[model samples]
Target: NLGSPDERPALYRERSPVEHAANLDCPLLVVHGVNDRRVPVGQARLYRDRLRGLGYEAGEDGDFEYVELGAEGHASSDIDQKIRLFRVLGDFLDRRLG
Candidate 1:
């Protein structure tokens, strides 16, 4: 993941996925943990909002998708939570590639 945009403005902007969102030609599925301290959920929301502003539609079968896992941090130690996250990821991959 890229460093905080505040700390490394140029590098952050250069590496940020959001900055390159407009170039995206395929679908995108963004998954974020609500409790993530390393990368706050707001970052994901910002990207989604910006993509929408750039005329990207969001839905399970649209140009972009977002999922927020509650009670989860940057990464989870809970087995069940991991499984659930992976399932969501797998579903996304299947839909995108299917």
Candidate 2:
């Protein structure tokens, strides 16, 4: 790790995905587990909201999309949930790269 953001402000800013939102040229799909303790869902929500503020849209065929899974922690425990997440990711990539 580069160290905590408080200790390395410049490096943290450079590494933060949210800081480069304006430069995004491709579609984005942000997925998060609401029950996540490590990196809370709010962080993902903030990123998606920021993207939307910068003129990104949210939809299956839009420039940006977000998915929140309930009852899921840092990682989902259910195999079905994992499958769904992968499917969504695959579809997102296909639509973007096709």
Candidate 3:
């Protein structure tokens, strides 16, 4: 009862318990592999976008973050990229969760 008819149930499930706000108290960060095949990076991005729109840091109303590693897939097999990835992740955590 909350959207255009074109929306399928499964697709809408993630948006359930809908939230619409411009500011929230919490924050979040998400690191994802661009080449992920199982859940697809799109889904994670979708979640981030939704949250961002609502004002949660993890969402639009807040400080939500999404990191996509290129040529890394689900796991960073490349040593160089892996090291950089860890450094970025570490920085993100230190700055956000520190």
Candidate 4:
């Protein structure tokens, strides 16, 4: 664990991906589970918003992609969910590195 944000504000600020969105130099893929309790879905949304604020669009044709799985939390257990995640990852890699 990274520790509490309130207890270690500077560490959190320094380690936050959103805080360093300007340093991104390649395609990014952010996948998050809607039911994630360890790291809430809002964090992913915030990161996407931050990237957008910095003029980076999100999608297959954009600089990044954000995928939210409805019935997942922290990790995937269902077969369909796993397949979907792999497909998304594969597509992103193919588009970026093919």
Better of 2 and 4 by lDDT: 4
- Per-model TM-score versus the true fold: 0.87, 0.83, 0.62, 0.94
Reference-based lDDT, each prediction: 0.91, 0.86, 0.65, 0.94
* Model 3 regions more than 4 Å off: 1-25, 57-62
lDDT of 3 by residue, 1-98 (tens): 66653777655655543333234344555778888886578877776677666645542334766677776577767899889888877877677677
**What is the full ranking by TM-score, best candidate first?**
4, 1, 2, 3
Q: For model 2, what is the alpha-carbon lDDT of residue 83?
A: 92
Error of 4 at 63 (Å): 0.7
Which stretches of model 1 miss by more than 4 angstroms?
1-7
Off by over 4 Å in 4: none
**RMSD in order of candidates:** 2.3, 1.9, 6.4, 1.1
Candidate 4 residue lDDT tens string, 1-98 = 87898989999999999999999899999999999999999999999999999999889999899999997999988999999999999999999998
Residue-level error in angstroms, candidate 2, position 14? 1.3
